[model samples]
Target: MPNNSNENSPPKVSRQILRFLVIGGSSVAIDGICYALITTWSGISPDVAKGISYVCGMLFGFWGNKVWTFESTKRSVSEPIFYVLIYACTLGLNVGINRAVLLLAGDEFRLLGFFLATGTTTVANFVGMKFLAFREQLPADSTTSAPSSEPPEVAIPVSDRRAA
Candidate 1:
């Protein structure tokens, strides 16, 4: 029974990572679609359209990560502020890397540059969120207990001690 209980423990960190990846992927798709539509239909510059789309995507990513991925229901004023700060920092990094890639790869292969930039940013964001944004929730619960440091002593047979 005890062993069975241990087997049922939830895999916390892996589950959290998987959830974050899934949500982040969805948010990126949303951002890309929004940026494409705005640039194509509204005659907006790609940069402006990307900025607007990023903000929308950031909002989706924040709520998705905060509530679903981290299971963090703490909604104090500071929460949003901290999240926004992180988003802004990541966004700046993303844009810088994207521009650098474009410059290096040349205008002819700008699309490839953008893809590489996005991939890099995705990995960076995942690491940042795991370590910085959600490091508070450590030592997740498990059913199994660790063995005690003290050595166990031999015990007399119960029947021998009682009757003999």
Candidate 2:
């Protein structure tokens, strides 16, 4: 049988986690910059700016997570569509968490609300992406078959051996 030892090896979990964190950091930076710029220069309302920035940031996050974090080079047509669906679902969760935090903390502590909201969203996104979105990268099976040790053997009758 052909050697297949490497097939059973587990994925590089640490590396994947690190890449995810790095991509998430970059996405956060993009979101913050876009939010700040539009709010400051474009005369956009804070809510509108936040909405635009969130979309932009999500795009960045999707691309970064797909290409860099997961190392997925699949250019299949379904990939982007799947990503968009996930992003839209997560966006709703993000907004809901943000609003909930804001309401609980009251308007006086808006900064705290924002931080709490972002933190919760980040955790949720990471868990979802790592476990569900990129599960295909990891091996699906655990058991492997190795070659048997017993060798083929034959026995001849004593009478036949003597005659020969």
Candidate 3:
């Protein structure tokens, strides 16, 4: 189990990083497979296929990071809205990177361009998701109460005490 306290501390940060990496790997697989299937099976423009795959990946990324990576349970009417904001920013950056890479690398290396775009956007997404969008909140019970570090005192029943 990862420590939920001190997210900035080395150990907890490392845990978060590890969990983020796991979720990132899953998102990559989902995006890659969906993109391939959509492009191969459908006659739609590659841009359209890419957009659909990106949306699917974005939704999965949001849910996976919220529940598993951050274990976030904080509730607010604006959370989804905040998520949209992050999505838009990251998506725009990703698209920009893709176009730039394609232009620089040439169409013959399209796959490389795609990978570069994905890699850059993924790093940005992780940073935003970790620090802003779904920042971890302390467990609900932690706010109102504090647990003692000392061992808890337990009262023995009268009969058990006599036996001793």
What is candidate 1's lDDT per residue for 93-122, written digit by digit as tens?
878877887788778877886777677777
Model 3 Cα lDDT, one tens digit per residue, 1-164: 64455657888677877898887788778988999999999998999999899778877877887888877887775556777787789789988888887888788878887888888877887788777888766554564357878786789999899877
TM-score of 1: 0.57
Q: lDDT of candidate 2 vs native?
A: 0.73
**Distance from true position, residue 24, model 3, in Å?**
3.2
Candidate 2 residues lying further than 4 Å off, grouped into runs, are: 1-11, 87-124, 137-164
Q: Rate the local accuracy (lDDT) of all candidates.
A: 0.74, 0.73, 0.79
Report the number of the highest-TM-score candidate: 3
lDDT for model 1, on a 0 to 1 scale? 0.74
TM-score of each: 0.57, 0.56, 0.60
TM-score attained by model 2: 0.56
- Residue range with the least summed lDDT across 10 consecutive positions in model 1: 1-10
Q: Judge candidate 2 at residue 80 and give its lDDT.
A: 66
Error of 3 at 42 (Å): 13
